[model samples]
Target: MNASPEDPLSQRPSRIRVDLDRLSHNLRSIRAHVGVPVMGIVKANAYGHGLVPVARHIQAQGVEQLGVAFLEEGIVLRQAGITLPILVMGGIFGRQAVQFIEHDLEVTVSSLDKLRQIEAAAEALGRKAVIHLKIDTGMERIGVHSYSAAPFIEAAVASRWCELKGIYSHLACADDPGSPMTLQQLERFQEACAHFERIGAPMPLRHLANSGGILHFPQTHLDMVRPGIMLYGVLPDPVSRRTVDVKPVLSLTSQVIYFKVVKAGNPVSYGATWAPTRNTRVVTVPIGYGDGYPRGLSSRGQVLIRGHAYPVVGRVCMDQFMVDIGDDSAWNEDEVVLIGEQGDAAITVESLAQAAGMSAYEVLVGLNLRIPREYRYS
Candidate 1:
């Protein structure tokens, strides 16, 4: 069924359906595989699957904690009445540390200065600020350098108002089990942990495995594991797909709102990039780059209609695109599958990413909020 006529989602021609049961199953599978507390990564609007709903669902499934990229994201979850421990995994501005304390959000300490700011914020609030110290094993995007992490760890340990809750480092290449860099980063993180132990500092909860690490490097699963994409049933890397058993949890779909026949030699859409070689039937779907469908897929994209594959034969516009359905007669409101299975055919996120010259992460998170997400539990 497309949608009931009274359903608000049906009012929009395009929507993303999220299977929460599949999400829960993925979480169970991941937790079983890692045998550790899972800190569900719900950042980027739960990788564009819907943040609060996803977070609430994961929490209900017994997730010990949640991770978000920014303090505001954490605050949003808090405002939604989520009481689960949430860690803000992004870099923090010194002035914003108080919000972390006030909201009871765990802060990520990447530098000594940020640590002091958090300490002061906690002191002023008459509360303790829980934090995870991020060490730069690789990815160089954030976190203190592992070799130079002692001072930061020492400061965190010494702080009266800041509680060192955990220590973590991001993996740069855990997706490729064959890459020695992951092992190298693991060693560096271990050395940093040893430094903490040698200083007689309380060793905080240690975690280093992301989705890729959780699937490929079992040893990296320490006190806990932070999984993002895999929890949504998408592999962190294509190679990991062979090693893990999970289902895709999201499907982008739209309804065919208009259909017409194009005479041979007539151009299809803007820029005149494609023309029908023979008189054929074409259908317009109410989805485009404006809906986070990649514009790059313009002429290269494919969609499923009536269980048949149809090529997206024109430049993807701001709000609509056309597909050549051959000579088959199509009518308004015909179901179109953009990133899901239809009969024997399927178009996956990975395939769409390849067509758009982007990553699966990009394709998932790039899904604009304009497309309402409808939840399903079966």
Candidate 2:
């Protein structure tokens, strides 16, 4: 790890280091591939990459718009002095409409009911609500059904208080090559676009390509693209194996707080689930379930020390876990990397997710807020 020139190792214990340089490269690369207005998705704390910092950095790169899953996330960006246009991917609820309008944030109207509520709120505020219509496409989650979309679009366009700025849909199976659902969704979205054009409704900014859709489909890149996971430097799916050549922006590092030796047949950690069949060098790390390292990782997980992979040898305790270094004397009170590169050997987020039986998205976002995040450009 590169330390600050002024004060090397000034404050070090446990931290998540974010590589701003890598983030910039990823954002630029994804934008080049999409060839359209790229809205950086910063929901779930920028998919656990630290929201405010990520947003500010991406915004500096000239990303015009941002998307978040909740209204509060938009507020956080606004509070952080981010003046870029932000859209709440999910629609605002009853009481949230006022807050959304107050901050000049855009809202996605997923349901007619949500549009009605937004209309009521807009009427009270005496301002037209800038809304995006989320079409069901094939996801069948929140969007209007394909067969009934025409009527819904007509109603929305006719509303006096609602200004439809965009018509968007989400891809459900773009990551899975075997799933033909994406093609169907694309056809449905194009159909909706055609309807809007035929009816003389302003062709709102049409966006349907998400990260997976942009990378896998390419043909679905409409007016705008939302890149979330790709911004964090990982392939969208296992099959694509067309590695996104982007650098990982997050590195998890911790110090060896203490160490000990266990005689043969001695057990370690809770439930005594792990036993040292032979004498072993045990190292304790100050990280556990509360810190976002999945509790389920217990004995199955691995950590890196001196560029070597070591087995996690016990039930991961609340705030600590044991690593059996196997009588190796190369380790002591030294820094260790639970996730990220260590020398030539490295542990990718994919490995951690596999060990914990989680998707790469979950692994990144699962990192709890308790862990301090340190941002660096070099």
- Expressed as tens digits, the lDDT of each residue in 186-243 for candidate 2 is 9988887788878987788998888788778877888999888888886666664443
lDDT of each: 0.90, 0.83
In model 2, the clashing pairs are none
What 10-residue stretch in candidate 2 is worst by lDDT? 1-10
Q: How many residue pairs collide in each prediction?
A: 0, 0
Tens digit per residue, CA lDDT, model 1, 168-187: 99999998878899999999
**CA shift at 263, candidate 2, in angstroms?**
1.3
Number of the top candidate by TM-score?
1
After best superposition, candidate 2 residue 340: deviation in angstroms?
0.7
